[model samples]
Target: MRVAVTGSTGRLGSALVAALADAPFTGPRGPVAWTRADLDLDAPAGVVQALDRDRPEVVVHAAAWTDVDGCAREPELALRRNGEATGTLAAACAERGIDLLVVSTNEVFGGDREDHTGYAPSDPTAPPNAYGRSKLAGEQAATDAFERAGAMGSASLGIARTAWLFGPPGRDFPHKILDAAARALAEGQPLRAVDDEWGTPTYAADVADAIVELLAEDALAGVHHLVNGGIATRATWAEDVLGRLSIDAPVEPVPGTTWARASVPPRWGVLAATPLPSGEPMRSWQAAMADYA
Candidate 1:
């Protein structure tokens, strides 16, 4: 199949690209890697033109305005870039009879829920912050486009929502915690983490693998949640990382409100994975972190 991946240079996107190359359905051309220069979301009108040119059988839309705090500060820009731009791409794909899978976030749910088991794919969405609101809008737009495109022969639309992605050697949470632990030990202070906030810490590689498997199975329609099997708060996740590294520096737990940020992340952003092709949930974050470490 002729597959195309957007945000190909990013952490998760890079993993997806690598997975596709190793996938059974990968064509001789492999996956088309598109950076912002190739398909800028800022210019929505050119989306269809690009789609026509690439003529990809499947387009995995991973590009987004990922700066949560920045999105909170400039909500309108967030909506334009993440929401409206996605709608344009979805409409374009629908018209061309191309299957599309949009990468989404756990933040789409209002995190204020008392339940901790994790949100299901069919749960009602109620975003608590600006970034979540924008992503939810994108999801709605994509669904709307699919509905409008009557009798889309082989076309399918999938939404894969993930949470607290951490992977790639020096760019994510584990590395950040290591750095913070080093600093805290040197300064004789404890590393502080938010205990009140809870979510799954998913490995990018795992999510990418799951996505490739999903595509191979032709299960690209409806909402899917791809996350690690278990859940953890920021503090517990940090402790796990530190324990794996044998770091002895103490990690202090604090409320989410202790550190003020422009955006509010979902407190309980955990998402239960939909039944995967193998009929098994993804491995636990601890196991994934071990490989990453």
Candidate 2:
């Protein structure tokens, strides 16, 4: 099957492109990478025109305004880019009968609960911040589009929600931790991290692989939590990365309140994975990090 991925150069997008190339199910056509220059979400006309030009069997919408703090500062722009743009894409895809899989976030769940377990796909959503709300809007928009097209249960629409995603080609959480370790070592201070904020640190390549498996198994519809096996607090995750790098810099555990940001993330952003095509648990973040390091 021919597949195209938006946000071709992004952390997860780039990984998806690579995974698609190696995936046997992609067939001889391989994968097409659509950058923003090719199809900007801000311009619905261009999106529709581009979709018509490319005409891939499947479109994986990976582009988004992922700057959480920036989204908080400009909620309207976030809604326009992350929410309304998604609706535009979903509508176009549904009209053309093209399968669409939207990459979403676990932040859609309000982490107000003081529980240790992860959120399932069927859990009630109550996003606490603008970024989460915007993403949730995108999810709803996709669902609405499919339903309007009389294809709600056709398995042609999908939402792949992931959490704490980290990988190469960008300054993700693990990269920041490594940078902080270097800075702390030079300044003679310990790296401070939030212990209360717990999440599963997912690897981008792994998520891409899972997404491919879902498509191959014809299980792309509905919500799927494609996260790592285990959960870790910010401090513990930082410690693991530092240890893997052989950096002896001490890490100080602190509450989430101590590390303030413009946007408020779900303290419990962990997402429980559903049964994968392989019928095995996703790899642990530790093992993925080992390969990354």
Candidate 3:
């Protein structure tokens, strides 16, 4: 099918675009991408214009103001992009009878429940920060828009709530850690990372695959957490990267207070794709890392 994707150059969007191009159902139009210049979220009205221009049957809404701390400082700007623009896009998609598949976040849940396994799909959302709140608002808006508009015959809505996204060659955690380890090793210095925060490390390519799978399923609806199958502290993940690189330097654990930010993210924001099809689970982060390496 004809597919239009937003945020074509973003960490996850690029992967989705590539995956869509390789997907079995992608049409001759291919996966049309609309960057910020093409569809400015600041101007919600432009969403309709861009959608009209692309005229795709499915729209993967991946663009968002992702600066978490920046969003906390400027909720209005964040909401305008993450919330209002999403509503506009959803409404436009509904009007055009196009399927809407959106990228949501694990931050929507109050990640304060550290002792728990993780947030499930059925859990009641309680966003702690503006970024999360805006994302939650967008999710609600998308659902309402689809249900109200009654997606033209077979058109539907699918929400992929992913977390701690990584997996780009020079942008993923492993790359950064490996780079730092290489540099530090050259200078004989110790590595340090935050230990307090914990979350799943989702590979962007894997998540993109999951998103394509989600879109293929016409019966799928509502939210689905599309993250890797494991969780770990920031420091531990760093250690794993270091070990894989065969770097002898030890990484010291630091607390969150060491880094000052306007927003306070959840301490344990692990995500679980509850009620998923039995015998289907995301591959482990370690396995994904191995593939990336």
Candidate 4:
């Protein structure tokens, strides 16, 4: 089971490498190979070439254009990375009869709903922002590739949609909040955060572990929400991080409108989780955060 992982330098990608390094299941017979530079989002042809060369049993697609506001500003770039690249990679894997596990996002559901409940895998998708639209396009492209490949060389595609991931090797929301708190404390100023936006804050390691589990499962196909179990607002998450850091800086809770950001923030709760057919829940966000601190 030689596995080829893209975006080896990203937050989740790095964690996936580390997880596979320590995983007992990934032995000599099932080695995990990582490619960061040679096969990147900009070079889809290179990605296809790498897949052909490696002929890996599984290809974990993690590279993407993740900047929400940037996606809104430059949709063409987003489409190139998130949409076109994904389609190309899926086609490549399909041609070689290699399984592909695509890492997706909860943003596919426009966070405009009033309710803050968890979104199931079957929920209707209505992406409000350009980033979500591009990710949704990637998902559709992967599915289409599998369909086009037919029964002969089609690969098994699993779209794992996650949310609010944070961890080492990259900047995430928790790290950002902690850094802002530290800066505020050093400057003797108050930290302000948006209290309205709500979602699950997942740890990258946990998401990586879930991906490994999903890969090992036999009947795990189609779309699945792989987020932590709990939900919290941005302000609450900020306060929690501050508390973990032993910083008492006053975290001012402000509405989302106060931020005045370029991109349209998802107002409705974006936190989501779903049990696999195996009846196992994803890792807990609290435990993942504890590891972060």
Model-by-model lDDT, in order?
0.89, 0.89, 0.82, 0.79
Tell me the spans in candidate 3 whose CA falls farther than 4 Å from its real position: 147-154, 179-189, 275-278
Clashing pairs in 3: 1-25
lDDT of 2: 0.89
Task: Kindly report which residue pairs in candidate 4 clash with one another.
Answer: none
* TM-score result, candidate 3: 0.91
Q: How many steric clashes does model 1 contain?
A: 0
Tens digit of lDDT per residue, candidate 3, span 3-99? Answer: 8889888988899999988888886556888798766889877777777777888888889998999899999888889998898898888988888
Candidate structures ordered by lDDT, highest first: 2, 1, 3, 4
**lDDT of candidate 4 vs native?**
0.79
Worst 10 residues of 1 by lDDT: 145-154
Model 4 lDDT tens row, 43-107: 78777667666678887888888888999999888978899889988888887788888998888
TM-score for model 4? 0.93
TM-score, per-candidate, Cα-based:
0.97, 0.97, 0.91, 0.93
Report the lDDT of model 4 for residue 190: 85
> Where in model 1 is the C-alpha error above 4 Å?
151-153
Worst 10 residues of 4 by lDDT: 29-38
Error of 1 at 29 (Å): 1.6
In angstroms, the error of model 2 at 83 is: 0.4
In model 4, the Cα lDDT at residue 26 comes to: 68
| Per-residue lDDT of model 1, residues 147-232, tens digit only | 79862555999999999999873468888888999999999999999999889899999999999988999988889999998879
Q: How close is candidate 2 to the true structure, as a TM-score?
A: 0.97
